[model samples]
Target: MLTPWRLFLCQMALNIFYHIAKEIGEMESKWRLLHKANIKLCSQLIFTFITWQMSGYLTTKNSSLCLGGQDIFATVRENSPTGEIIAHLSINGDPGASSIRLCLTGENADWFYLEGRTIRLNSSFSRTLDREVLGSVLIAALTCYEDDIIRSRYRIMVEILNENDNMPYYLEDTIQPRYISELLTVNSMVFTVKARDGDGDTITYMTDKSTADASYFRIDLPNSGMVILDKPLDYETKTQLQVVIFAVETTTKEKYSTTATVTVNVLDGDDQYPQFQPCAPVYEDGDHNICTNPVYSVNITETDEDAVLYFSPGPIHAEDGDKDILTPLVYSILSGDGNGRFTIDSKTGEISLRQRVENRLLTPSFRLRIMAAQVNDPKKYSVATALVHVVSENRFPPFFNKTVYKGFLIESSSPATLVTTYGNQVLVVQAIDRDFRDGINPKIHYTMQPLTGSNKLYHISQDGIVIAKTDRLRAFDRHILEVIATDEESGETAHASVDIEVLQRGQPVPRSPFGEERLFGDMNAGMAGGIAALVLLVAVTVLFLFLWLAKRRRERRDPADRGAVALGKHPNVEASSPIAPRHVL
Candidate 1:
């Protein structure tokens, strides 16, 4: 290879010689020397032109030399399978030398070896498209510009491109759906996902084979989201389910997925049987069976899921001749309207017997039918029946009060008292009933009243106590008080009377005698006492005046009294009259 300065020096020398030769061109020797220098100049120009053409040709080639479309471009793979590379080059073409030298010029371009080289083509050698080259290798090919003259050239081209071999995957590696239903609707978009391929064309859309009815779910072609809903759901038959969906590539058929599920719960409505929780009191060994006593009472209850619900039953009829339904019947009760033998509560669907049986009469069997009807409809109803067994027991009612007391006492304060008072002492009425506190239906009420002929002075308490309202008492008052106690459940009542006496602790004093004695005593003693008091006051005043006068006369006789008195007349002067001779006289 020739340096730029060497080539310049050679050209300068040639120019000087050619000018000299032209001056002497008439001689053959000078003409031949000029011709040789010109040829040498032509060869250098041609070599430079060939180098310029090779660079342009390689830069714009169709990636490779070919006749029928086979083009193999060099490629570089880095962090990714496809990346970018840059190249730089320097070339020296020696016109006089036999070969050209080629070398890469930059850090990245060092991978290519372009040392001394030459381009040679045989008569039959043609450009082939599929020739493979090892990396950045710089090859020089010769092109002749003129007859018998040749120049070596250097060429390089960079090829950066893409690949398509990556598998399809969820953009986030996981996905979620708004909801999953036992019966999903068609075309509902479930998720949005994406993936990448190194080969640039490896991915496509497909279904997840693991999912139920895999064909039922599909992925969108462009955006890679899913659409689902293969069938209808029946909550009654099937309440819940699970499903899996996937994103897949069309070419490689590779897939990744996330799973989701839906829950469908069947609600309980007003369809259950109106069960008659346990009814009737459990029998005890100590209870005695009685005719008018209550056998049992049942409270009814029902359930529903609807916001509002109601219950109804057929018309209620008495099992016995009496109108009391709270009392038990002697046999199994049947509803007249429905297909059942048990008696159902018209308000609440509770069933119970109408009567209690004696231990000897107790039977081991009783059959009854119960039904539940809708409150809104008369015909809409459901029926259930039950068989009951009665065991021997002693359930019975308390006895009535028969021992009556004497006539009731008469006094004030009796109407509202819970207990009656005799001489300010309250009296209690002892009574008894055998029914259990809870078993007593409707409650018992007692009422008391004085005999009709008795004076208006007597009254009875609201609780049936008879007492005297007036303070006036009399012997043998003999007031008749009536006691009536009625059972609220059986409507049976009993009546009795009590004799009462109104007596005081002391005997009564005569009103006239007492008034006269008090009046005479006050009049006689008060008059005598007033006269005696006046006489004593006059005596005291006369005694005080007499004693005062006596003390004055005694003081006049004392000469000491005159010495102490100062005289209007002087001691040395004589009085005009005898009685005035001296102050003492």
Candidate 2:
């Protein structure tokens, strides 16, 4: 703190320099002819002002002068028995209030005393200022400076707060429907309803309808707000049910109840067995063995509350009501075959024959009882009775003997005698009856004739003739005769015929050809010549090979021969030049 008293001394020195520079300025303008002298005087005044402005260092060093917002205690000494008066500003430094200016009012307050004022200590200077008679003073600028010096010891603190500003709801609203069987046990996880919140905060769960098992449902973990079913579900008794859920926030405990209907549809399980209604009986019509048509109208039906199941029947389950447990009404067989050839529709309960019956040995009418089994339950069967009636139709056609015999003649050559050829002709009949021969008759009849050039005439004896009728016939001739048998009821008949051709008994006669003949008979001469030419070519090839071999041997033996000489010289010339000379010398 620079004392006001010291500041007074510095103010007086500053005023003196101020007045001297003002005087130098006034004198320099007045003495223009003494320009060099005026210039040096101006320079001296400028240097003096700069030195005085920087003179604070020589007075108080580097200590700060505290001024505002501080508390301090100051004291002043008037009479100094110890040779000089020292105005010591001693501050009771409160760490909280380091320094502050306090206007200390007192008597004789003519001087505002600044602290740390250095006055020259001398006997005469100390004589007027008293030391022991010191008085209290105010710490003005000095108090503030001390406050800054103590500020680093204390620290400041602050804080913020929380608020409830979030909302509670499921992030996803829609959910899928779940299906389960009514037969499921309790505590089974049929489905889990999940929900979420945008705030990532804790969430809660509730139920819209609390009347039925609502307490079992609740959100499980953190954000997994899911509804769990605590009981079993059944579809047969209860087809479908809705589970309404309400979501809430765990933190704020605020809830917005949204009824997301979790549909629990119960599915059908294997519950109902099949059952069947009764069917009608089957019958037969016409001759028993020839009956080829089935007759019946017996249908099988079934029903169940859970599900209408299938129906089935076995071979014993005939179309005839005699075999059925329940006979059909108003549906009767018009014409039926007695064979085991009938069936009934299990699902539609429509009774009809399996196929058009076709078998011999089967009865014309059937006294059968059709038995039908339930589609869902094959063990349960029912049966009914049928009365079969057989009607007689056309009898089977009559059959004749398969073999037919023709008469033979024993005659000599020219003017032959009439032989008994008719006696060799046997008209035999063996007829069969499909109706087991119900009093039917079969007979044989015959007539005879002799061929032309015959000598004697003969006649049938009326007991199946053995003689020929030469007067009405020619000798050595050909003829055909037939005998027929028929069923008396159907008029269906069968016949057998004899074909007679009288043959002369001797060696056969030879005949001559019509056109021309050659040496090779019917063979073509040009074709034969071509074959001879091929043979000649093969002979010539063999001969040429033999001659070539013979000539080659002769040339090898005769080395001096002309051909051998030519062969040797030809190779020499060819070896010398590949091109052969046009004319050899």
Candidate 3:
């Protein structure tokens, strides 16, 4: 015999089967019906079936069987084994019901099974789901049955909460190489890092503190995996940097992380000026100022016929302080090169003469001012000077200013007499070297050759000055003196004959047209006396003028009382002037 509760559940089960068959038939004919009508009917049937199933399980009038009304949640580990109980389901009014059975049905019913009141995994369950089948939230219908009949139907939601089983790893195993200029501003974007977690957990990016200093960089978390430069970089100090980046799960208690190496190559920039190597210590001038730049000396002789005259004076070198190593430098002649005789390599600091020096006798020495600058920035530079000394081979002899020089002296003139003043330079003979572009030659010296005379009458000074040795000669007498100009280095010589004419005391000298002899003693005495008399006259005139001006000022103050005279008068005299006149007389 079937009980009333049993019979009611049996009827509900038949109703459920009928509704499910009808839904299938409607689905096949769904295209034929109006879209709205079909949807409305399907919804009504679903709601009625759920209501009927709930009402069958409630035995008492006050008992309620909530279908999708009461919230149900279950947490399951990802990839759980089949038949693993996730959570137990309970009907509100059921306690110790021997005939009650739990059945799972819905879109994801295939993934779970029901055992009495417990919900267990029927198949291997993965947290990762396809939206077409089952979304992130697993919804199923948990139905209580009695004797193979539906009693109550409840909608349950199984949320597969993620666990830290899967570690976070970088999307790319290695980061792409990034190039950043040393001059890049701080807080600039360097590169981005991307990471993924199979468990769908929030991932945080960070730099490995042990690998490199994290102070110079910062990482954006969660969605954005961008890395930025927190501080400036210098290529000179460090050329390349490797930063280890870690991607970690934010919710994991353990330190589960994935690492990737980011190679940051610092590029060179034009930030530093060129610095020249310090030359030899240079002495300061008298005024404590650097009179000369760094000097490099090179000796070139006439016999030296090398094809390339390398300027090895001091190997010019310049370095860019901003670069990790010395960069390319350019060399140029800044000044002191009047002629285009030398050229230097722009990349290398090697300097060479463009043309060979045919004659070193003329130009014994010269100087050149050279500049070294970085190739990147030419304006940033340093300057140095080089002195080139030449050794002559005496290809040409010295030449005199004049072939014949005429001189005059007074007859019986005293030794070292004022024949010619060094300041005036009357009897000067200049010798020049044709080998040099500049006519003046410092090597050639002047001297008087041996003359046919008992005593050396006259001699030529090194500076080409003719001086008389003694005061012994006759009037109208003449002497011919030969001045030999010799080159100290080349041993070459040239001579010029100087003709000297003697004159009497009154006769005019040949070269001294202004009459060089003068009585300086008398002239000086006259000049002194004239100056003293003029000073005395000026003093007397000033004193007389001062006295006359004083007398005129006194007269202007007392004009009317100039000639009046006062006489003493007796006190008792009655007449006005009889006693006064006697006293006055």
Q: What TM-score does candidate 1 get on C-alpha atoms?
A: 0.25
Off by over 4 Å in 3: 1-82, 86-104, 123-136, 142-154, 194-205, 212-231, 248-252, 272-297, 302-307, 313-331, 338-364, 372-377, 392-585
Per-residue lDDT over 178-237 for candidate 1, one digit per residue giving the tens place of the 0 to 100 score: 334433446765444455544444444455557544544555563445444444443333
Q: Write the per-residue lDDT of candidate 2 for residues 390-424, one digit (tens) a residue.
A: 23345456554454545544333434333333333
Best by TM-score: 3
For each candidate, how many residue pairs have backbone atoms clashing (under 3 Å)? 37, 54, 1
* Model 3 lDDT tens row, 274-328: 6555434356554222223346666667565433444443465666766455667
Better of 2 and 3 by lDDT: 3
Q: How close is candidate 2 to the true structure, as a TM-score?
A: 0.23
Q: How many clashing pairs in candidate 2?
A: 54
* Per-candidate alpha-carbon RMSD to the true structure: 27.6, 38.5, 25.7
**lDDT, ranked from best to worst:** 3, 2, 1
Minimal lDDT window, size 10, model 1:
300-309
Per-prediction TM-score to the true structure, in the order listed = 0.25, 0.23, 0.42
